[model samples]
Target: MDNHFVPKLTRRALLISTPFVLAGCTTASRETVVTKPIVPAEYLAMYDAVDGEPYPVDAADLTRVDPAFLRREVAYNTPEPTGTIVVDTQARYLYLVGENGMALRYGIGVGKAGLEFSGEALVQYKRQWPRWTPTQDMIAREPERYGPLASGMEPGPLNPLGPRALYLFKNGVDTLYRIHGTTEDWTIGKAVSSGCIRLLNQDIIDLYRRVPPKTRVIVLQGPASGYGV
Candidate 1:
């Protein structure tokens, strides 16, 4: 098992948990559920299918996903003020800092694109059912895959950006990185994506509703609690 800085979780957080096996960044692995996880009823309901949207969202099959990646409220120790967003790329977790040392944590999937941008940034804006356009670098790297769609892809269930997207910016300029939703729920804890951070469609929707424009977001490059840029 790789070494990771486990956060000082609250008793409430610990009581509602199990042995969460962290997956590797290079390859995908099935979580070894030694003891049945005592998942809260509310957590399960949060991922349930939605009734009205631009498209239908299927309920997340928690059985196939690692419990560590599931959304939970944890005791996060960060200097960043409440309402700040922190992304621990190495741990594949994103935290929305809340008052009283608490945070709303979500599992994330990173890739080369996701790792490209790090450090402090702000949520310039957000979009629901946002259109997606492949970057020039992406077109150059995988022409056949992204070339034809250079113009842009309309928002829908098939769109890679999923249903909601939070655009990140630095110095008031677009960083081309985004915190968005993904159709590949199985990839929640993996490092396989064409672009930036991805959360489950259900999870993204929840995050979108919580944060507004200009929200501060800190993307930590290494271990979960590594303060370094």
Candidate 2:
């Protein structure tokens, strides 16, 4: 008797099995899959707030709130007691008066009372990350302070006004004082500006979007009712 035994096999079975082995080898040699990086949802939300535009790295950097930070507690909702802004230079507060004698109060940084004005004005123009040009008087008063930029300071984080600015006008002439954002949040409730009203960057950004061009603005020397916070 022969020690070896022969087994029958189909040609088709051998052909089908050969290709599967080859397929395994081919698949192993193929490139790995790659995916594009996705931006975070918080960043997307911030982008949407700014008209869905990506932050301009070269233009200016605005102070951004940390998405994780807890918002400050307010006794009332913002856009509070909505009326109009009444800047009281004497009290160092801007009141947003609401109905029924209710008011939303916000601390403000005001200019020296002597240098400030009181009257009705309107928002004639607005700018984003506006340029800072020191007036001739500003240069003369503090040459060392502004000597670095004889021409003017271009838009940037360091600029006195952080991000947005609203130009106030009376009749048809510019008042030369602006309601704008400030890098110095600590200055709120104090007199530190040169006849301009300053708000925190975040606060001003919120206000800028709400107010339209030609909105009535009144600067009052004394406190007034119907102010909005």
Instruction: Judging by lDDT against the true structure, name the best candidate.
Output: 1
The C-alpha TM-scores of every prediction are 0.80, 0.60
Kindly give the number of clashing pairs for every candidate. 0, 8
* lDDT (Cα) of model 1: 0.79
- Top model by TM-score, which number? 1
Name model 2 segments beyond 4 Å from true.
1-83, 96-104, 224-229
Residue pairs with clashing backbones, model 1: none
TM match of model 2 to true structure: 0.60
Cα lDDT tens digits, model 2, 34-139, are: 4333434433333233333223322112223222111121122223224455566776655444344444444467887576867988778778888878767667
**Which 10-residue span in candidate 1 carries the lowest summed lDDT?**
1-10
lDDT of each: 0.79, 0.57
The residue ranges of model 1 lying beyond 4 angstroms of the native Cα positions read 1-41, 113-115, 224-229
Positional deviation of residue 175's Cα in model 1 after best superposition, in angstroms: 0.8
Clashes of 1: 0
